[model samples]
Target chain A: MAAADKVDPIHQFQIHPIIPLHIGGYDVSFTNSSLFMVATIVLASAFLYMSTASRALIPGRLQSVSEMAYEFVGNMLRDAAGKQGMQFFPLVFSLFMFVLVANLIGLFPYFFTVTSHIIVTFTLAILVIGTVVVYGFAKHGFGFLKLFVPHGVPGYLLPLVVAIEIISFVSRPVSLSVRLFANMLAGHITLKVFSGFVVSLSAFGAVGIAGSVLPLAMAVALSALELLVAFLQAYVFAVLTCMYLNDALHPSH
Target chain B: MFVTSAYAQEAAPAAAEGDTHAGTAVPAAEHEAFPPFDAKTFPSQILWLVITFGLFYLFLKRVVMPRLGGIIDVRNDRITQDLDHAARLKGEADAAVAAYEQELAEAKVNANKIGQQANDAAKAQAEGTRKKLEAELEKKLGEAEASIASIKAKAMKEVGTIAEDTTSAIVEALVGGKTDKSEIAAAVKSASR
Candidate 1:
């Protein structure tokens, strides 16, 4: 690449090994991504531990936040998966807090975004779909396959309708994983690009320095938007997981 | 080893390198060398993700969720108990009010009954007094009528005596004067009849 092209926007996503380890010729080295994941877990644990340690009748601010998060997921699960689906409250709550903390951690400058990677998001998506499948089969036996068939379809269109339903059902994980991954990736890239413009233009004469304000403003705005997107994506992930679990518990429709 | 310096260096070579060369002198490198897209790191990422997520799930299920649910349950129980206590107090108040009103009504009735009894007793006593006075007056009138009858009889007897005397005297003056008392009395008796 030319020297001007060395200001690579995509370079921000590089995963360098902090502690290189090789096990059975498979590289399971602890990288920046792992560091951020660990950070997310630690931070989440601290928040939960401190907030709930008191268990006060009249909650303080941190306790209120903790309870709000709990009830938010609780209500979502109840609304989407019905009362019976509260059994998965732990899993859904964990996922929401993990993703939310991970995304928020990424907002800090130079911090690695664990959710921006496809592997992490894809694994979470797989876990969700796996739970749905395993529980659906266990709960309903072969009747779970009926999920691919609509109830009120005409006789002639049954096969085609079932095929479409099966395709959409299979696409759930892909859509779920890609939605979070792509959103995080795109938001980071946009932010990096705008910041790059600020740096590149500031290197010019006084005119260039004055013009750099526009990209800086754009970067600021994008950062705010990314923060909102971070929260929204986490919420969407949890809600969709609940919906899929609902399908598992009740596969008739 | 310093991550911040390394990240800064990686992010902006234009500012760090200070406009070293013109456009096309450097080699054309792969711009798409994004580490997240690299398939090699997938295994490590997935491994740590599973481990961390598993630990998190266990922590939440075992420790955090139960505590939160318990706190909420306790608050709800306290609220219900308070409501029941309030309802019991309200029922007590209503009963007390009802009892007070009943007592007030009974007292009013009692007052009216006492007044009626007192008025009836006074009326009976006055009626007895009036009847006693009427009996006394009737007795006095009877005695007075008996005395007047006796006086009238006495006065008639006196007048009859005087009339006999006067008749005897007149006979003496006019004729020879020897009148018998039995004959004079018999004449007075016949004249008075």
Candidate 2:
């Protein structure tokens, strides 16, 4: 067997260059993963744009659905982030749509999973966390430091509590990126492995084909689970982003 | 220590494992080397970010936000209109209640006046009737008294005539013959004594 044929399933997750290009000192390769990420954003915008192009008094089904999704996230932001939460609506709403579209697009055969990459997920996470920090400082000035110093803690335990708060605050971006990337990575790999099994078993004529049925069934089940996860990851991302924003807005609680 | 060793043992073959049948053993360099960015790509991450942000911003400013604001404004207007209508209705109701009460008070006063008037009229009528009846009775009594006095005078005159006649008859009988003047004078004197 050739070395190329023995490719590891895990290493299959790679950002291959879509276009071969080089700059001064930078090897800026246009990758397949970048293409999909762009596509996801385009598709998401188009979905929202087409859905809400016509604002009917008695809205059509698509319009109603899009409106419901809008209100749902708006209400969630309002609930989590309060009346002032609307300021962050565009950011949170975009994150939800972007992540949701990327995950769903990756489910197709021969598609690049952009969200499965750490850099993409980290970029979004950093944006959210950075906004929270910047906004917190802008709003509260020096008082934003109170977020680290827990209120009503006993004097003796204040130092220990502050240390814990600092760590938790620092871990926000890590946790956020990991949650999205890990889920996408795990789900896609599982689907790929199961699908590989189905292909392998089908080579042995009718008996092998019959044996292939088990993995095929498993693949189907995992695909359905992956679809659920696509929506869940998007929801989780949006909600956590809301919570962090809430902390920034209301530093006391 | 046990968990670390166990995880290391399990991970050893897993890392070495590969798809030999596909004839594509991915090099270690592919895994380790950071895949740098290329600009000629038709759809890029930064481009998508710009597009998404632009589209979303436009929708929010132009389409979605305006419609939502309109809905909220309509709701607020509706609430204010309802409150105003209710206040107007209440005002009308209060006026009606006040008017009814005023009418009731006026009616009460009018009824009391009418009652008082009726009582006074009745009282005046009764008093007038009583006065007229008493005057008539007084006139009848006076007439009766005058009639009695007149009848008494007539009776007295008749009695005087009868008494004089009887005295003259007694003097005539006692004198026995033609001595009229002397006999009459004697009789008068005796009767006076």
> Which candidate should be chosen as best, given DockQ against the real structure?
1
- Per-prediction DockQ comes to 0.34, 0.07
lDDT of 2 by residue, A29-56 (tens): 4556657766886777677667666655
- Cα misplacement distance, residue A169 of candidate 2 (Å): 2.6
Clash number by candidate, in order: 3, 16
What tier of docking accuracy does candidate 1 attain?
Answer: acceptable
Query: Total clashes, candidate 2?
Result: 16
Off by over 4 Å in 2: A1-67, A83-85, A101-114, A140-143, A151-163, A189-228, A250-253, B1-47, B54-58, B61-63, B83-102, B140-193
Per-residue lDDT of model 2, residues B1-193, tens digit only: 2222333343344335422101222333332332222222323444444455556556555666556545545656878999999999999999999999999999999999999999999999999999999999999999999999999999976765566667677756886554455555566557656
- Real interface contacts reproduced by model 1, as a fraction: 0.64
lDDT of 1: 0.86
* Residue A125 local lDDT, model 2: 92
lDDT of 1 by residue, A1-253 (tens): 3223324556667776677777787778788888889899989988998898989999999999999999999999999999999999999999999999999999988788999998899999999999999999999999999898879999999999999999999999999999999999999989988887887788898989999999999999999999999999999999999999999999988
| Model 1 residue B130 distance off true place after TM-score fit, in angstroms | 3.4
Docking category of candidate 2: incorrect
For this target, which candidate reaches the highest TM-score against the unseen true structure? 1
